[model samples]
Target: MLDEGFTYGGLLMGLAALVLWIRLALRAFPSVETMIARYQDEFVVPEARSHGELGRIAACATAMALTFSAIGYAIPD
Candidate 1:
């Protein structure tokens, strides 16, 4: 169980990093709006005005990172 938790924590860390990287990349490329709109045709948007999806993804990633950190702290040596 401990090993599995550790593995999941690492995966979450990687995902968090990827999300942060994408956020930075989007910031660098202001043209992301066009790409996002292009991809929008693939699905329905529930909250079109709520900071978009990327913002929510980043927020979720940040929350996962914090949860992992807390789990790590609770793990035994």
Candidate 2:
């Protein structure tokens, strides 16, 4: 009962996180290209390279969501 609810909740949370991170990564893609072109000759700081970080986060979120959903479904009702 309570455990089932928690399992579903975690699954849903993971899915939501995956969606948000993917959205952010997509939005940042264009800007990332532009930033690279604009700063081709300059030394861009690590803090400014957020698009790469967002991509990594999105990938992790996707993996997390997949694992969470798998575990949730594998749990016996």
Candidate 3:
């Protein structure tokens, strides 16, 4: 079962999703920081707050995806 295409394909897909979520989550943080730095003149920037919210959402999604990846890896077909 482990050598079969289904298992390999599923693993590959899980890995790809995990990587994408992690990358998005990481990028959101820096982008938020940059926006805040670039717009320091403004007392409050809605865009920065939105980006921060996006970062939190992405981080949560990444954590969930990572947990699923770990579970998938731990359990064998």
| The candidate that achieves the highest lDDT relative to the unseen native structure | 2
**lDDT on C-alpha atoms for all candidate structures:** 0.65, 0.67, 0.59
For candidate 3, the lDDT comes to 0.59
- Write out the backbone clash pairs for model 3: none
The per-candidate count of clashes, in order, stands at 0, 0, 0
What tens digits encode model 3's per-residue C-alpha lDDT throughout 1-77?
Answer: 43344445555665765766676666556556657766787554434434555556656655655665566566676
lDDT of 3 at 45: 43
User: Backbone clash tally for model 3?
Assistant: 0
Q: Write the per-residue lDDT of candidate 2 for residues 1-77, one digit (tens) a residue.
A: 65466567668768777787768856755557568856687755544545667677767766776776676667787
List, residue by residue over 1-77, the lDDT tens digit for candidate 1: 77457657857775876867676565654355556876887443443233456666766776777677677667776
Error at 69, model 3, angstroms: 11
Residue 7 in model 2: shift from native, Å?
A: 5.0
Number of the top candidate by TM-score? 2
